[model samples]
Target: MTFTLATWNINSVRLREGLVAKLLGEEAPDVLCLQECKSPVEKIPLEQFAALGYRHIVARGQKGYNGVAILSKTPLEDVDGRDFAGLNHARHVAARLENGVVIHNCYVPAGGDIPDREANVKFGQKLDYLSEMRDHFRAQRPHKAILVGDLNIAPREDDVWNHKALLKIVSHTPVEVAALAETQEAGRWVDITRQDIPSGNLYSWWSYRSPDWDAADKGRRLDHIWATPDISGAAHSSRVLRAARGWEQPSDHAPVFATFDL
Candidate 1:
Protein backbone atom coordinates (compact mmCIF):
# COMPACT_ATOMS: atom_id res chain seq x y z
CA MET A 1 0.00 0.00 0.00
CA THR A 2 1.07 3.55 -0.62
CA PHE A 3 0.39 6.33 1.88
CA THR A 4 1.15 9.99 2.46
CA LEU A 5 1.97 11.51 5.83
CA ALA A 6 2.25 15.05 7.11
CA THR A 7 3.75 16.40 10.32
CA TRP A 8 3.01 19.79 11.80
CA ASN A 9 3.31 21.72 15.00
CA ILE A 10 -0.15 23.27 15.32
CA ASN A 11 0.91 25.34 18.41
CA SER A 12 -2.49 25.07 20.06
CA VAL A 13 -4.87 22.46 18.76
CA ARG A 14 -7.92 24.06 20.38
CA LEU A 15 -7.13 27.55 19.19
CA ARG A 16 -6.45 26.42 15.64
CA GLU A 17 -8.73 23.46 15.21
CA GLY A 18 -10.21 25.24 12.24
CA LEU A 19 -6.82 25.34 10.50
CA VAL A 20 -6.37 21.67 11.17
CA ALA A 21 -9.77 20.98 9.71
CA LYS A 22 -8.94 23.09 6.70
CA LEU A 23 -5.75 21.13 6.08
CA LEU A 24 -7.55 17.84 6.42
CA GLY A 25 -10.31 18.92 4.06
CA GLU A 26 -7.75 20.16 1.58
CA GLU A 27 -4.49 18.14 1.56
CA ALA A 28 -6.06 14.96 2.94
CA PRO A 29 -2.89 13.11 3.82
CA ASP A 30 -3.53 9.55 4.91
CA VAL A 31 -1.93 10.37 8.25
CA LEU A 32 -1.29 13.71 9.95
CA CYS A 33 0.89 14.00 13.03
CA LEU A 34 0.77 17.21 15.01
CA GLN A 35 2.91 18.55 17.82
CA GLU A 36 2.55 21.32 20.41
CA CYS A 37 -1.17 20.69 20.69
CA LYS A 38 -1.35 22.46 24.09
CA SER A 39 -4.60 20.79 25.09
CA PRO A 40 -5.89 17.86 27.10
CA VAL A 41 -6.47 14.72 25.06
CA GLU A 42 -10.22 14.73 25.53
CA LYS A 43 -10.42 18.46 24.83
CA ILE A 44 -8.87 18.06 21.39
CA PRO A 45 -11.50 19.15 18.91
CA LEU A 46 -11.84 15.89 17.07
CA GLU A 47 -15.44 16.06 15.92
CA GLN A 48 -14.56 18.25 12.96
CA PHE A 49 -11.55 16.15 12.06
CA ALA A 50 -13.59 12.97 12.41
CA ALA A 51 -16.22 14.49 10.22
CA LEU A 52 -13.48 14.94 7.66
CA GLY A 53 -12.94 11.12 7.70
CA TYR A 54 -10.02 10.97 10.11
CA ARG A 55 -11.47 8.41 12.49
CA HIS A 56 -8.27 7.13 14.07
CA ILE A 57 -6.36 9.16 16.63
CA VAL A 58 -3.48 8.47 19.01
CA ALA A 59 -2.42 11.33 21.18
CA ARG A 60 -0.57 12.39 24.30
CA GLY A 61 -1.64 15.80 25.55
CA GLN A 62 -1.22 18.23 28.46
CA LYS A 63 -3.70 20.93 29.40
CA GLY A 64 -1.77 23.97 28.14
CA TYR A 65 1.62 22.74 27.18
CA ASN A 66 3.34 20.21 24.98
CA GLY A 67 1.19 17.62 23.19
CA VAL A 68 1.35 15.33 20.16
CA ALA A 69 -1.36 13.60 18.14
CA ILE A 70 -1.66 11.44 15.06
CA LEU A 71 -4.95 11.49 13.19
CA SER A 72 -5.42 9.00 10.40
CA LYS A 73 -8.03 8.31 7.76
CA THR A 74 -7.26 4.61 8.06
CA PRO A 75 -7.40 2.68 11.34
CA LEU A 76 -4.39 2.78 13.64
CA GLU A 77 -3.47 1.32 17.02
CA ASP A 78 -1.65 3.21 19.73
CA VAL A 79 1.74 1.77 20.50
CA ASP A 80 3.78 4.13 22.68
CA GLY A 81 4.04 7.43 24.51
CA ARG A 82 7.64 7.91 25.54
CA ASP A 83 8.86 10.45 28.08
CA PHE A 84 12.40 10.86 26.89
CA ALA A 85 14.73 12.05 29.67
CA GLY A 86 11.92 11.32 32.13
CA LEU A 87 10.64 14.90 32.02
CA ASN A 88 7.14 13.38 31.76
CA HIS A 89 6.05 15.97 29.17
CA ALA A 90 3.39 15.02 26.66
CA ARG A 91 5.94 15.18 23.85
CA HIS A 92 5.85 11.85 22.09
CA VAL A 93 3.32 9.33 20.80
CA ALA A 94 3.33 6.39 18.41
CA ALA A 95 0.79 4.40 16.41
CA ARG A 96 0.72 1.46 14.04
CA LEU A 97 -1.34 1.20 10.87
CA GLU A 98 -2.72 -2.13 9.66
CA ASN A 99 -0.03 -2.29 7.02
CA GLY A 100 2.59 -2.70 9.78
CA VAL A 101 3.84 0.81 9.35
CA VAL A 102 4.57 2.47 12.67
CA ILE A 103 4.67 6.23 13.04
CA HIS A 104 6.37 7.90 15.97
CA ASN A 105 5.37 11.49 16.54
CA CYS A 106 7.46 13.71 18.78
CA TYR A 107 7.91 17.33 19.92
CA VAL A 108 11.39 18.01 21.19
CA PRO A 109 11.85 20.83 23.64
CA ALA A 110 12.89 24.19 22.19
CA GLY A 111 16.08 24.72 24.12
CA GLY A 112 15.91 28.16 25.69
CA ASP A 113 17.64 31.31 24.44
CA ILE A 114 20.85 30.37 26.20
CA PRO A 115 22.16 27.00 25.03
CA ASP A 116 24.39 26.55 28.05
CA ARG A 117 23.07 23.90 30.42
CA GLU A 118 24.43 25.53 33.58
CA ALA A 119 22.74 28.78 32.68
CA ASN A 120 19.47 27.34 31.36
CA VAL A 121 17.50 24.40 32.74
CA LYS A 122 15.40 24.07 29.59
CA PHE A 123 18.55 23.79 27.56
CA GLY A 124 19.74 20.96 29.75
CA GLN A 125 16.38 19.25 29.44
CA LYS A 126 16.57 19.44 25.66
CA LEU A 127 19.98 17.83 25.58
CA ASP A 128 18.90 15.17 28.06
CA TYR A 129 15.83 14.41 25.98
CA LEU A 130 17.97 13.93 22.88
CA SER A 131 20.43 11.72 24.77
CA GLU A 132 17.63 9.45 25.89
CA MET A 133 16.30 9.25 22.34
CA ARG A 134 19.68 8.10 21.08
CA ASP A 135 19.96 5.50 23.77
CA HIS A 136 16.41 4.22 23.20
CA PHE A 137 16.84 3.86 19.46
CA ARG A 138 20.20 2.20 19.87
CA ALA A 139 18.57 -0.41 22.05
CA GLN A 140 15.27 -0.93 20.23
CA ARG A 141 16.65 -0.86 16.67
CA PRO A 142 13.45 0.23 14.98
CA HIS A 143 12.67 -1.12 11.49
CA LYS A 144 10.01 -0.25 8.94
CA ALA A 145 9.12 2.73 11.11
CA ILE A 146 8.87 6.44 10.40
CA LEU A 147 9.37 9.26 12.88
CA VAL A 148 8.09 12.79 12.47
CA GLY A 149 7.99 15.92 14.62
CA ASP A 150 9.05 19.43 15.47
CA LEU A 151 12.46 18.15 16.49
CA ASN A 152 13.30 21.81 17.19
CA ILE A 153 16.84 21.50 15.87
CA ALA A 154 17.97 22.70 12.48
CA PRO A 155 20.90 20.35 12.04
CA ARG A 156 21.95 21.17 8.51
CA GLU A 157 23.73 24.38 7.56
CA ASP A 158 21.21 25.05 4.80
CA ASP A 159 18.33 24.39 7.19
CA VAL A 160 18.47 27.88 8.61
CA TRP A 161 18.19 31.28 6.95
CA ASN A 162 21.72 32.21 8.03
CA HIS A 163 23.78 29.36 9.35
CA LYS A 164 26.84 31.40 10.37
CA ALA A 165 24.82 34.08 12.13
CA LEU A 166 22.66 31.48 13.87
CA LEU A 167 25.60 29.28 14.86
CA LYS A 168 25.43 30.64 18.38
CA ILE A 169 21.63 30.61 18.38
CA VAL A 170 19.83 27.81 20.20
CA SER A 171 18.36 25.75 17.35
CA HIS A 172 21.31 25.97 14.95
CA THR A 173 24.09 25.73 17.49
CA PRO A 174 26.78 23.12 16.95
CA VAL A 175 26.05 21.32 20.22
CA GLU A 176 22.35 20.89 19.38
CA VAL A 177 23.12 19.90 15.81
CA ALA A 178 25.69 17.33 16.95
CA ALA A 179 23.24 15.93 19.48
CA LEU A 180 20.51 15.54 16.85
CA ALA A 181 22.99 13.91 14.49
CA GLU A 182 23.86 11.40 17.18
CA THR A 183 20.20 10.62 17.78
CA GLN A 184 19.61 10.09 14.06
CA GLU A 185 22.59 7.79 13.84
CA ALA A 186 21.29 5.70 16.73
CA GLY A 187 17.98 5.13 14.96
CA ARG A 188 19.63 4.68 11.54
CA TRP A 189 16.98 7.12 10.37
CA VAL A 190 17.01 8.80 6.99
CA ASP A 191 16.12 12.48 6.96
CA ILE A 192 13.52 12.17 4.23
CA THR A 193 13.29 15.92 3.70
CA ARG A 194 16.95 16.45 2.79
CA GLN A 195 17.05 13.09 1.04
CA ASP A 196 14.35 14.13 -1.42
CA ILE A 197 15.01 17.84 -1.75
CA PRO A 198 18.84 17.49 -1.46
CA SER A 199 19.79 21.15 -1.90
CA GLY A 200 18.07 24.38 -0.90
CA ASN A 201 17.33 26.83 1.91
CA LEU A 202 14.57 24.56 3.20
CA TYR A 203 12.66 25.74 6.21
CA SER A 204 9.59 24.60 8.11
CA TRP A 205 9.44 27.23 10.85
CA TRP A 206 9.45 31.01 10.86
CA SER A 207 9.60 32.77 14.21
CA TYR A 208 6.53 34.82 15.01
CA ARG A 209 8.88 37.43 16.45
CA SER A 210 9.65 38.51 12.91
CA PRO A 211 7.30 41.35 11.99
CA ASP A 212 7.51 40.52 8.29
CA TRP A 213 8.25 36.80 8.45
CA ASP A 214 7.58 36.20 4.77
CA ALA A 215 9.51 39.17 3.40
CA ALA A 216 12.35 38.64 5.87
CA ASP A 217 12.29 34.90 5.19
CA LYS A 218 14.17 34.19 8.38
CA GLY A 219 13.21 30.59 9.06
CA ARG A 220 14.49 27.18 10.13
CA ARG A 221 13.80 23.60 9.21
CA LEU A 222 12.92 22.68 12.75
CA ASP A 223 10.33 20.11 11.78
CA HIS A 224 11.35 16.81 10.19
CA ILE A 225 10.26 13.41 8.84
CA TRP A 226 12.49 10.36 9.11
CA ALA A 227 12.14 6.72 8.19
CA THR A 228 14.16 3.68 9.11
CA PRO A 229 16.87 2.80 6.60
CA ASP A 230 15.06 -0.37 5.60
CA ILE A 231 12.07 1.51 4.21
CA SER A 232 13.82 4.79 3.41
CA GLY A 233 14.11 3.90 -0.26
CA ALA A 234 10.36 3.80 -0.63
CA ALA A 235 9.93 7.35 0.60
CA HIS A 236 9.84 10.38 -1.74
CA SER A 237 8.08 13.66 -2.54
CA SER A 238 9.28 15.32 0.61
CA ARG A 239 8.25 18.96 0.99
CA VAL A 240 7.38 21.76 3.35
CA LEU A 241 4.01 23.46 3.02
CA ARG A 242 5.47 26.96 3.32
CA ALA A 243 2.16 28.71 2.58
CA ALA A 244 0.74 27.33 5.83
CA ARG A 245 2.89 29.79 7.72
CA GLY A 246 0.84 32.61 6.15
CA TRP A 247 -2.46 31.09 7.23
CA GLU A 248 -4.75 32.93 9.61
CA GLN A 249 -3.24 32.89 13.12
CA PRO A 250 -0.88 30.25 11.90
CA SER A 251 1.59 28.31 13.93
CA ASP A 252 5.17 29.49 13.65
CA HIS A 253 5.96 26.06 12.23
CA ALA A 254 4.65 24.81 8.89
CA PRO A 255 3.84 21.24 7.91
CA VAL A 256 6.32 18.78 6.33
CA PHE A 257 5.17 15.90 4.15
CA ALA A 258 6.39 12.72 2.45
CA THR A 259 4.91 9.73 0.60
CA PHE A 260 5.89 6.09 0.84
CA ASP A 261 5.22 3.11 -1.36
CA LEU A 262 5.30 0.01 0.78
Candidate 2:
Protein backbone atom coordinates (compact mmCIF):
# COMPACT_ATOMS: atom_id res chain seq x y z
CA MET A 1 0.00 0.00 0.00
CA THR A 2 1.12 3.51 -0.75
CA PHE A 3 -0.02 6.42 1.38
CA THR A 4 0.94 9.99 2.02
CA LEU A 5 0.76 11.46 5.51
CA ALA A 6 1.00 15.07 6.60
CA THR A 7 1.47 16.70 10.00
CA TRP A 8 0.81 20.29 11.02
CA ASN A 9 0.29 22.37 14.13
CA ILE A 10 -2.87 24.18 13.10
CA ASN A 11 -2.76 26.34 16.28
CA SER A 12 -6.54 26.29 16.49
CA VAL A 13 -8.51 24.00 14.26
CA ARG A 14 -11.86 25.71 14.73
CA LEU A 15 -10.50 29.14 13.97
CA ARG A 16 -8.91 27.78 10.78
CA GLU A 17 -11.45 25.18 9.74
CA GLY A 18 -11.65 26.76 6.34
CA LEU A 19 -7.92 26.48 5.89
CA VAL A 20 -8.12 22.82 6.86
CA ALA A 21 -10.78 22.30 4.24
CA LYS A 22 -8.64 24.08 1.70
CA LEU A 23 -5.73 21.79 2.46
CA LEU A 24 -7.91 18.69 2.30
CA GLY A 25 -9.21 19.86 -1.06
CA GLU A 26 -5.84 20.78 -2.51
CA GLU A 27 -3.23 18.39 -1.11
CA ALA A 28 -5.45 15.55 0.17
CA PRO A 29 -2.98 13.41 2.01
CA ASP A 30 -4.29 9.98 2.90
CA VAL A 31 -3.92 10.94 6.55
CA LEU A 32 -3.36 14.28 8.25
CA CYS A 33 -2.21 14.65 11.83
CA LEU A 34 -2.79 17.90 13.65
CA GLN A 35 -1.35 19.36 16.85
CA GLU A 36 -2.36 22.28 19.05
CA CYS A 37 -5.96 22.08 17.99
CA LYS A 38 -6.97 24.20 20.99
CA SER A 39 -10.50 22.84 21.22
CA PRO A 40 -12.50 20.17 22.99
CA VAL A 41 -13.02 16.95 21.06
CA GLU A 42 -16.75 17.53 20.74
CA LYS A 43 -16.22 21.08 19.58
CA ILE A 44 -13.99 20.27 16.61
CA PRO A 45 -15.68 21.05 13.29
CA LEU A 46 -15.70 17.57 11.93
CA GLU A 47 -18.51 17.90 9.38
CA GLN A 48 -16.38 19.99 7.10
CA PHE A 49 -13.49 17.55 7.16
CA ALA A 50 -15.93 14.71 6.74
CA ALA A 51 -17.36 16.44 3.73
CA LEU A 52 -13.86 16.44 2.31
CA GLY A 53 -13.72 12.62 2.73
CA TYR A 54 -11.68 12.58 5.92
CA ARG A 55 -14.35 10.89 7.97
CA HIS A 56 -12.19 8.90 10.34
CA ILE A 57 -10.85 10.93 13.24
CA VAL A 58 -9.31 10.08 16.59
CA ALA A 59 -8.43 12.97 18.82
CA ARG A 60 -7.64 14.08 22.36
CA GLY A 61 -8.42 17.67 23.17
CA GLN A 62 -8.80 20.20 25.98
CA LYS A 63 -10.91 23.33 26.27
CA GLY A 64 -8.47 25.84 24.85
CA TYR A 65 -5.04 24.32 24.73
CA ASN A 66 -2.83 21.46 23.56
CA GLY A 67 -4.72 19.01 21.36
CA VAL A 68 -3.89 16.36 18.80
CA ALA A 69 -5.99 14.67 16.14
CA ILE A 70 -5.63 12.18 13.34
CA LEU A 71 -7.92 12.54 10.34
CA SER A 72 -7.81 9.75 7.84
CA LYS A 73 -9.51 8.90 4.60
CA THR A 74 -8.78 5.27 5.27
CA PRO A 75 -10.30 3.24 8.07
CA LEU A 76 -8.56 3.37 11.43
CA GLU A 77 -8.79 1.25 14.56
CA ASP A 78 -7.36 0.96 18.04
CA VAL A 79 -8.14 4.56 18.83
CA ASP A 80 -5.99 5.52 21.80
CA GLY A 81 -4.50 8.55 23.51
CA ARG A 82 -2.20 9.14 26.47
CA ASP A 83 -1.47 12.04 28.77
CA PHE A 84 2.25 12.03 29.09
CA ALA A 85 4.18 13.63 31.99
CA GLY A 86 0.97 13.52 34.03
CA LEU A 87 0.17 16.97 32.71
CA ASN A 88 -3.41 15.84 31.95
CA HIS A 89 -3.16 17.84 28.75
CA ALA A 90 -4.65 16.43 25.61
CA ARG A 91 -1.40 16.29 23.72
CA HIS A 92 -1.46 12.89 22.04
CA VAL A 93 -3.60 10.46 20.10
CA ALA A 94 -2.96 7.24 18.18
CA ALA A 95 -4.79 5.04 15.71
CA ARG A 96 -4.09 2.05 13.53
CA LEU A 97 -4.56 1.74 9.79
CA GLU A 98 -5.84 -1.43 8.13
CA ASN A 99 -2.26 -2.14 7.17
CA GLY A 100 -1.38 -2.40 10.85
CA VAL A 101 0.52 0.89 10.77
CA VAL A 102 -0.04 2.80 13.97
CA ILE A 103 0.16 6.58 13.64
CA HIS A 104 0.91 8.66 16.74
CA ASN A 105 0.00 12.32 16.73
CA CYS A 106 1.61 14.43 19.44
CA TYR A 107 2.13 18.01 20.58
CA VAL A 108 5.05 18.61 22.85
CA PRO A 109 4.87 21.60 25.14
CA ALA A 110 6.56 24.74 23.79
CA GLY A 111 8.75 25.52 26.74
CA GLY A 112 8.51 29.15 27.71
CA ASP A 113 11.03 31.90 26.77
CA ILE A 114 13.57 30.96 29.41
CA PRO A 115 15.57 27.85 28.56
CA ASP A 116 16.49 27.32 32.20
CA ARG A 117 14.25 24.96 34.14
CA GLU A 118 14.97 26.83 37.35
CA ALA A 119 13.58 30.02 35.86
CA ASN A 120 10.70 28.48 33.92
CA VAL A 121 8.38 25.77 35.13
CA LYS A 122 7.22 25.08 31.60
CA PHE A 123 10.78 24.35 30.59
CA GLY A 124 11.04 21.80 33.37
CA GLN A 125 7.75 20.28 32.28
CA LYS A 126 9.02 19.96 28.73
CA LEU A 127 12.10 18.12 29.88
CA ASP A 128 10.09 15.89 32.19
CA TYR A 129 7.64 15.12 29.43
CA LEU A 130 10.43 14.10 27.09
CA SER A 131 12.05 12.00 29.78
CA GLU A 132 8.76 10.17 30.34
CA MET A 133 8.39 9.61 26.61
CA ARG A 134 11.83 8.05 26.52
CA ASP A 135 11.02 5.82 29.42
CA HIS A 136 7.69 4.69 27.97
CA PHE A 137 9.17 3.89 24.58
CA ARG A 138 12.17 2.21 26.11
CA ALA A 139 9.93 -0.04 28.16
CA GLN A 140 7.33 -0.91 25.53
CA ARG A 141 9.28 -0.46 22.29
CA PRO A 142 7.36 0.35 19.14
CA HIS A 143 7.18 -1.37 15.76
CA LYS A 144 5.42 -0.48 12.51
CA ALA A 145 4.64 2.93 13.93
CA ILE A 146 4.79 6.42 12.47
CA LEU A 147 5.07 9.32 14.89
CA VAL A 148 4.46 12.88 13.76
CA GLY A 149 3.96 16.19 15.52
CA ASP A 150 5.09 19.68 16.37
CA LEU A 151 7.77 18.32 18.65
CA ASN A 152 8.63 21.89 19.76
CA ILE A 153 12.39 21.31 19.62
CA ALA A 154 14.72 21.75 16.67
CA PRO A 155 17.23 19.01 17.34
CA ARG A 156 19.67 19.73 14.51
CA GLU A 157 21.78 22.82 13.98
CA ASP A 158 20.53 23.18 10.40
CA ASP A 159 16.94 22.97 11.64
CA VAL A 160 17.11 26.59 12.78
CA TRP A 161 18.02 29.60 10.69
CA ASN A 162 20.65 30.86 13.15
CA HIS A 163 21.59 27.88 15.25
CA LYS A 164 24.19 29.60 17.44
CA ALA A 165 21.96 32.62 17.99
CA LEU A 166 19.00 30.41 18.86
CA LEU A 167 20.89 28.01 21.12
CA LYS A 168 19.58 29.88 24.15
CA ILE A 169 16.07 29.97 22.73
CA VAL A 170 13.55 27.53 24.19
CA SER A 171 13.06 25.39 21.13
CA HIS A 172 16.68 25.14 20.03
CA THR A 173 18.38 24.72 23.39
CA PRO A 174 20.97 22.00 23.79
CA VAL A 175 19.12 20.41 26.70
CA GLU A 176 15.85 20.15 24.78
CA VAL A 177 17.65 18.76 21.73
CA ALA A 178 19.44 16.13 23.83
CA ALA A 179 16.18 15.11 25.51
CA LEU A 180 14.41 14.77 22.17
CA ALA A 181 17.30 12.69 20.85
CA GLU A 182 16.94 10.35 23.79
CA THR A 183 13.23 9.94 23.14
CA GLN A 184 13.90 9.10 19.50
CA GLU A 185 16.59 6.65 20.44
CA ALA A 186 14.33 4.93 22.96
CA GLY A 187 11.69 4.32 20.31
CA ARG A 188 14.18 3.34 17.62
CA TRP A 189 12.51 5.98 15.50
CA VAL A 190 14.13 7.27 12.34
CA ASP A 191 13.78 10.89 11.33
CA ILE A 192 12.19 10.21 7.99
CA THR A 193 12.25 13.84 6.87
CA ARG A 194 15.97 14.22 7.54
CA GLN A 195 16.61 10.77 6.14
CA ASP A 196 15.01 11.92 2.89
CA ILE A 197 16.55 15.38 2.84
CA PRO A 198 19.80 14.84 4.67
CA SER A 199 21.28 18.25 4.10
CA GLY A 200 19.28 21.48 4.00
CA ASN A 201 18.11 24.40 6.14
CA LEU A 202 14.54 23.09 6.06
CA TYR A 203 11.91 24.68 8.23
CA SER A 204 8.20 24.30 8.91
CA TRP A 205 7.68 27.08 11.42
CA TRP A 206 8.36 30.83 11.23
CA SER A 207 7.91 33.19 14.12
CA TYR A 208 5.05 35.67 13.85
CA ARG A 209 7.46 38.18 15.34
CA SER A 210 9.04 38.52 11.90
CA PRO A 211 7.34 41.35 10.04
CA ASP A 212 8.16 39.75 6.74
CA TRP A 213 8.42 36.07 7.53
CA ASP A 214 9.13 34.99 3.99
CA ALA A 215 11.87 37.50 3.29
CA ALA A 216 13.50 37.20 6.69
CA ASP A 217 13.07 33.42 6.44
CA LYS A 218 14.14 32.91 10.03
CA GLY A 219 12.33 29.67 10.66
CA ARG A 220 12.72 26.40 12.57
CA ARG A 221 11.94 22.80 11.71
CA LEU A 222 9.78 22.17 14.76
CA ASP A 223 7.42 19.73 13.14
CA HIS A 224 8.60 16.18 12.46
CA ILE A 225 7.64 12.81 10.95
CA TRP A 226 9.32 9.70 12.27
CA ALA A 227 8.91 5.97 11.76
CA THR A 228 10.30 2.95 13.55
CA PRO A 229 13.35 1.38 11.93
CA ASP A 230 11.39 -1.61 10.70
CA ILE A 231 9.23 0.59 8.45
CA SER A 232 11.52 3.58 8.04
CA GLY A 233 12.91 2.35 4.72
CA ALA A 234 9.41 2.45 3.25
CA ALA A 235 9.21 6.20 3.77
CA HIS A 236 10.16 8.75 1.10
CA SER A 237 9.25 12.06 -0.52
CA SER A 238 9.47 14.06 2.67
CA ARG A 239 8.89 17.80 2.24
CA VAL A 240 7.51 20.83 4.00
CA LEU A 241 4.64 22.84 2.50
CA ARG A 242 6.31 26.18 3.04
CA ALA A 243 3.72 28.00 0.99
CA ALA A 244 1.07 27.13 3.54
CA ARG A 245 2.77 29.44 6.00
CA GLY A 246 1.84 32.33 3.69
CA TRP A 247 -1.80 31.34 3.45
CA GLU A 248 -4.44 33.77 4.62
CA GLN A 249 -4.48 34.11 8.43
CA PRO A 250 -2.30 31.04 8.62
CA SER A 251 -0.69 29.44 11.63
CA ASP A 252 3.01 29.96 12.26
CA HIS A 253 3.53 26.36 11.20
CA ALA A 254 3.37 24.75 7.77
CA PRO A 255 2.44 21.16 7.00
CA VAL A 256 5.12 18.46 6.75
CA PHE A 257 4.56 15.55 4.38
CA ALA A 258 5.96 12.11 3.66
CA THR A 259 4.84 9.26 1.46
CA PHE A 260 5.23 5.68 2.62
CA ASP A 261 5.22 2.62 0.39
CA LEU A 262 4.45 -0.32 2.63
Q: If scored against the real structure, what TM-score would every candidate get?
A: 0.99, 0.99
- Report how far off residue 156 is in candidate 1 (Å): 0.8
Off by more than 4 A, model 2: none
How do the residues 191-228 of candidate 1 rate in per-residue lDDT, one tens digit apiece? Answer: 99999999989999998999999999999999999999
Tell me the deviation in Å of residue 250 in model 1: 0.6
Clashing pairs in 2: none
Worst-scoring 10-residue span by lDDT in model 2: 76-85
What's the C-alpha lDDT at position 181 in model 2?
98
Across residues 72-154, which tens digit of lDDT does each residue of candidate 2 receive?
99898856787789999998899999999999898999989999889899999999999988998899899999999999999
